[model samples]
Target chain A: MENEFLPRRVRIEETKMMTSLEKWFKLDAQLDFKPGQFLEISVAGAGEAPISICSWNGVEICVRKVGRVSSALHQREKGDFIGIRGPYGNGFPMKEIEGEKLILVAGGLGMAPLRSVLQYVLKNRKKYGEVTFFYGIKCLEMMLFRDELLKLMEEENVNLHIAYEIEDEEIRNLKKRFPERFHKGMVTTLFEKVKVNTESFVVVCGPPIMYKFVLKKMEELGFYKERIYMTLERRMKCGTGKCRHCVVGIGSSSKLICRDGPVFSAIDAELIRELV
Target chain B: MKFLKLKKDQIEDFFDSIHSFGIVYAPVKSDGKISFRRAQNFSDVSLEYTRSQIPPKHVILPMEEPILKFREEEYFEVVDDENKVLLGVHHCDIIAFKMLDEVYLQPPKDIYYHERIKRTLIIGLSCIPDNYCFCKATNSFYTSDGFDIFLHDCGDFYFVRVATPRGLKVTENSKNLFEKVDEKDMELFVKAEKERFERVKGKNLWMIGDLIELRDENFWKIFSERCLNCGNCTLVCPTCQCFEVYDELEEDLKSGNRFRRWDSCMLRAHGLVADGHNFRERTEERLRNRLSCKLGEMRCVGCGRCTVYCPTGIDILEIVRALKE
Candidate 1:
């Protein structure tokens, strides 16, 4: 057979620098993908990087410019094409968590992948129960999808809670746009103010450091580890399972962030020591 | 099977004939030690050496390979290589190749690795074991499988056993250089090889099982301190398959090529993420990961290539023995 593992070139439809740490690129391809599965974007001459799909339906990648491949992604334009392979890894168990009260949390660029789930849940609104989006950023300027999110909150039956670590005045102007939803302080504080049943499913995505504190708050708020889900970021080289660059957990039993999961339940990720 | 009485003088002519078919690579003396390299002459190939400074892994899995090249938004293509024959590979190195094959050639096989592997022929040489050698621990001191042809040193002549149709073709074509197999000569050769292996093992070498037990022990701390985090071990290791892919841009900024290169877990950045969190931050953890992958994870295949090419002479077998305490 021919080289089946090779990536196909897909033109970039749109490109936006999400924050100082990340960039979002929407590819001109119909990639049938789940919320948590990721794609390996190849920058010709640079290398391939496994970036999580942030868009629900179309192929879009939210990449943090951390390493060589990511930095190259930021340099490309809307018309430029890059090699695209895979919608790999186990996505969030959307089918299983349907109809349960959902608490979605996004921290900084972590919102990129979690946004996929948010969009999915929003599209199929009546299929699930109450949906609460608790998005956290270092400041208002770092917030991604600010305009889209404002529009999302305006829709009926959606409870959106946006927070920043900086002073309240920084986000005061945004109050006019999202008067009822905007809140101050850390994202975890929303757990105290919000009320939900024990059957609620909480999804969290952020830096590795954010996990411990967020998980602690979830536990205090009567959310078990199994009820909470999170995504992990690692140095992935080959999106295919060959390179073994992204294997985590103890004993180095490979959990390919590219193939196994970018999103895992809090308890399911407990064995993974380095993931936040 | 054949016990051919070709003098050492005719070895160059054999290599010359093999070179006509394809490029032949073998261990050649470099600096003070031997390393696998393209062979220009038979005199440079060292079959008597214990082990080379580098495994023959690079012949298949190159240190730097271009997965694909792209020029702006116009064109993109991948580069494929030609066929070659690798000669004088040790049993340990061959076993390492097998381990690599199991991983890369598994379900959803890697096209890049498969392309190079398909065009290559493996010729294994049975060498007398040395103090540093511990292939027997992994049950790969001598391999009758995984090779197209197996060669054993029988005094003045070389005993060749063809294991594949390709190997049989090469032998049949060189009929003038080989003699028919004699039962008496085969028995004597096997007996001599067994005695040689036993003599090598009698020297107080480390046991493989002891190393497996020490994987969780405190012995890692001592070894970790000595490691400069240079990644030399992973670079020299034949079975270390970890890699990183990145894009390199030209001055125009509109075009670039994506390439994947060898990466090592021993490096500080191997486990680091974009947000500045390093999974294996401690030297002890990185060192332990490398050892465990070599001993426990890769133990079933029995490829001792890692032990053979360690620059610091960090015998993993010895480390495991120390851990057993």
Candidate 2:
């Protein structure tokens, strides 16, 4: 009999600017959640927006200043209190991918959710096979969790590949310093440089347009449709299924994205064409 | 279930007595539109109507409702506890009400909706279909549940089928207001039901095979061009439950109310995400999504309100018939 719309207050313990548009916040609450699950962040007068949980241990979320609620979040200081409800949606299938090779593909802001899975995978490194990380951004400035991605480059059994669209003097210098790890093009460009395992479980997250190209490249590289998992983003008003705004698929196959998924298999995404 | 008969002349007394239980909301003709309104007396109620422009759903899920009130760091829930009696609801709308219950009353139930629905009583009235009605095609012309009491017109009396304890309470309190149904009364009830069943020969637009499979571009193009996206169809739909939640602040900006307003998927803003990406950018895509969602879940009760209320005359049954062809 709990009210599903009610949000509990959580004070911000810390805040960091990841980019001009994306800001990171660490709350003073500990939430037990899976990787791809998102939080419905509430700013009283501004409204609510869904933010992806970017950290593994505590309540941390990445907010991009795109609309009203997120812009309000950007104006708040470290100690300001905000309302939060749910670590909703079916997150990544962490248990299913155990002992399988993980190829994490993140585009721009998509790194937030993938970061949660990456940290979980690295902590239990011996359980999994190899970890391949491919991150693509518009430029070096837009790269989220830059220091973390750099540190991940040195982790054992993990191969990190990065691609940036713009190649300025700074990007050129960085590319020269790390020739084998950096490439200049779309994230799909990194696929050709690496020796992909046909059996690897590929997890992708990114903008709407990026999915089509990335999935096509994965198909070309001989990855099974069922093995490729991607978390999708949709306009969700309520985290629960009652609000039909986040519905995907058609007819009997129709499923609420907020309840059934934020992460879905490539096969489901194929069947529900709206997901990609 | 119990069968009782109330004389046609006794309806006014029954209506007045039910006020003791709760506020009575029934069909009323006002400003050239027949809609549900609070009945102060039986004279204000209209029994002869095809359908209300806006459904009685607003009795439970209002067009605009406040779920929470926030002041600084504290938040409180705004729950309505008033008891209500929604009477004269058609069979199709009763089925539509059950569909709304299935969504809101499922796991992780909506407390606001639960509170309103629990406090309200529903009374179903048998209605003969007009040209706009296709409830028979949707299998919603006849309903055995989702109503406390059902009244079937039988000439001088109404054959009352009491399906719930709340319904029985009204008859019990009224004493001699309702009489026991005899064999002749049963025959009249059967004849009345038959007349209603035969009257619903509107359109046999029963949904064909998977509508998602019928995603023919040319077929959608002809209809999408005519769609104004005014969202009148969704507003009048009994089963369209999509909503948008937002907060409105006072002038001081210290306090605000979090409100959920009825929203339509036909609007562009419904599917637009944060990063300026709209999943349903074009009118064709929105139209397809709406039709497919309706067919997929069997959400369309075929009340034909959407067709009647639409400014562009985009008949849904016509589209369904074309798909069948």
Candidate 3:
């Protein structure tokens, strides 16, 4: 009962300045949570917000200053205290899709959650076949986790594709750092570059507008919708299903995105609202 | 079946007898609006009312509640509600509580809500449908369970059925107040039940096939029109249980409480992502979401609070009825 609303105080081990708007926080307390799961972090003045786990070795979450909670988190330095709860929501079913190819996509901050799978796949490299990650962000300033991304590019049997909407000096540095892996357009352009076969499995996370275009492109390229996966986000208050703020109706029956899913197969994405 | 008879003259004594159960809240009319208030005296309780403007669900999940208290980055307490007994709850609203139980009392159940439920007793009343009432249409007017006691109004007396053991004990303690019902009393009770059920038999607005086919985008805009997104509909609804959580700090910034307040999808920001993207951008989309959530294939208990409380007089049932066109 106490665990329902009580959050443990976790100290920030270290903080890396990703960009002006984003920062990476490494927690001293490592929680027993799977890849693709997220934690609700609450500060004093700002309320709780869900941040996706990007690291498998430690408790690391990437925070983007898009709202009040994250903005308040951005101001804090290393060793500051923050309230934490969860490892909530079903993560990517790694064991189910084993021995198959993977197509991982990340748009802007979407990279944070997908990075969890990226690290997990790299560790168990033989369990998966051709693994590809398509990461795209606006311009170059919003691009996150650059040092680790460059390390991922060098790994054998793993391919990292990067795209920038607009060019900047930071993007040029990234192009030089990863060499031939960088592209000049949106992430949709990366699909044209991919040799998407029947065996390839897909995991996608992005802004709400990105799903329609990305899914359409995947279908056009002979990618099966059943094998594709997505993580849907809503204004979730209670990570559990008690608060109905995160509910999305699929036909007549309703499902809470927090409890029923944050990770859903592409076919199951019907539970979320789509823009026409 | 555990029926007990309380004469019309003994209703006042019946209210006085319930104190040992918990603090009692019954429907009362104040400022030209009906609401649940603590029964200081039974004379203030309205027995002839159609429905209270707000459902008694607030007793379980309040509009605002302090869930956690923290001081200097350390949590010290989790607040829980005291014992309560809700009086004059309608059968439809009783059904709504069951739906709420399905949501909050499931696995990894809400501790705060379960704590509240453990301490509360429900007393249900049977209602004859009014102009704005549509519980019969939703098939929720008749409740078999989910209440401690159910009071069915019969002429010259109230037929009270003690549904739970706790209710039986309470009734037994007040044995002097109730008389054994005769054959004539049973006949009158059956007649009232038949008449109430027959009046709203053919006027159902909820059909699964009609709801599925009402997907025209042009039709959706009509829903948000002649309207304000004041969220009064969801606020007044017994089944609408969405909420938003916030953290408040003292001026010194050392201590504060984390609380949750009722929220509605009708608000433009209800679907806002943490990264600051509002998914339900248009008012039409917001309205579509609530309607789909309310009646799309899901069971509507048809409390009719939304229709009664809409300042713009947006009849949600009329829109569903229009779906046939």
Candidate 4:
């Protein structure tokens, strides 16, 4: 039996500084992972954190220095080896909504998983319909993949709208960089600026506090509950579903976010009231 | 069921026979408390225990279990093996293993736990619940399976039933010490195993299928009022599988082992996630989640460990019993 908890030490092939808090680590390991699936990266004595696979080939983990494990990861330089186990959890349902218009939404650090989903869709651009990506972060100083976001604007049939909650010198600098793409309010403000079809498939990933307001705004704008997909966050230990820490139940339905989902429909999403 | 009979006096021979298989552990009286310990002497193995102070689950999921022993790329899975024969396990514990097995042995299986299960054999004892035991009310009163063998203390003689091939092989060593149980002895053994169940049924009439129904602020006030948050209940639990894993560097500094230690939801740090979001920040919320999660009917296996070891005597069963009102 393969020990799921044992992490394989993989050398960091490349490292990129996206922002002060977030750094992207490209690992020298070929993992067959779905775009939005996650890998539990261990930093020896510091411990492990569940990081979403952010790149196309699935080795890159765009992580924020939010906790101990990630902070330890940020301290490590290129060519350093970190323990990794997974490419675990169900990713975004690409096949289910194939050829349908895709509205990708994210808030703050939530952009990590949505970036993987959007990049995969862009790989075979003709297979999907119009793709509108909406994102929001605290300020411009927290921006990640600025070069990549700018390059994505050149892609045909793709629309991008980004918002900053706090206005400062960083916001003015970002406005000078991409005047048309930047907005001045929360992610909810993007809906009025860019119109997506009411029946189009929507994917939303964000911090816990953003779910209620974002989902409510999407609902008021006529987006159906079943059409909205989301990735949930919980205190996950053993990602194999052994630990009950990540168990979230709604009504008669319950799912181990590690196993059954990190991805859930808005109907079942309502059941996990703790996220609200 | 294959039944064999042995006198209470002849039980020493059974313990003696157990040594050849492996180390045998049973209930022992030390420091005025009964805990499961190595049965070094047959005279010390006590079956008079209503329930053990510490569950035999530690034999599988220890307080600190190593997952990996590593030095960068060259790492090996750290696994501990011991051919253990655990004695004096009650019906509640047998039921508890079923729930723990569901968590560890199911797909996306835990190999560390699987390796331990392979090396261990359970020898069960029939339980007589005192006023404190509420296993029967949760519909986990008895288990016909899980252990390799089950022993019923039938007055003058001991009735033994072999439930597995491993058990039958162990019992074959001392075939001469046993006699076939008659129909009369079988009836008495079955009746005693089931009779105490009725007394516990009406105590907890709380509906748990939907958790929102059981929520009352007064119940929270009362349950958390005495809860010292010592986590003695989770430590003694046979079904609580929540663990926190971290690495400990050895003296060499180059290599170390990653340890998965038992963690409890009752702790303040248990619910704190990345980005500093605390799901259960309030004292009552943490207290409520533990009861609510178990009420969904998965984690708790009806072993009243928390109640038995609670310092302030906060009976979760009685608190749940009041929830019915």
Which candidate leads the pack in TM-score? Answer: 2
- The per-model DockQ list reads 0.42, 0.79, 0.61, 0.58
Q: Is the docking of candidate 4 incorrect, acceptable, medium or high quality?
A: medium
In DockQ terms, which candidate is top? 2
Off-target runs (Cα >4 Å) in candidate 1 are A1-7, A16-23, A45-47, A64-72, A173-180, A220-224, A272-276, B1-13, B199-219, B248-257, B299-315
Please, what is the TM-score per model?
A: 0.88, 0.98, 0.95, 0.95
Weakest 10 consecutive residues of candidate 4 chain A by summed lDDT: A246-255
Model 2: lDDT of residue A228: 91
For B212-273, candidate 4 gives per-residue lDDT tens digits of 33466665877787777777878888778889888788787668888888998888778778
True contacts kept of 1: 0.52
User: What lDDT tens digits, residue by residue, belong to model 1 across residues A143-222?
Assistant: 89877887877786668887778855647877776675666778887776666565689888887778888888877767
- Give the better candidate number (2 or 4) by DockQ: 2
Q: Go through the candidates in order and give the clash count of each.
A: 17, 1, 0, 0
Poorest 10 consecutive residues of model 1 chain B by lDDT?
A: B202-211
Higher-DockQ candidate of 3 and 4: 3
Q: Candidate 2 at residue A217, lDDT?
A: 91
List, residue by residue over A1-276, the lDDT tens digit for candidate 4.
678887888999899888888998888998888877888888886778888888785478888887878888998778888989998899888888888888988998889888888878888788988889998988877867877886876666689889888888866776787667888889999988777798889998899888888889988999988889988787787788877677665323556788988888888766664545
True interface contacts reproduced, per candidate? 0.52, 0.79, 0.62, 0.48
DockQ of 3: 0.61
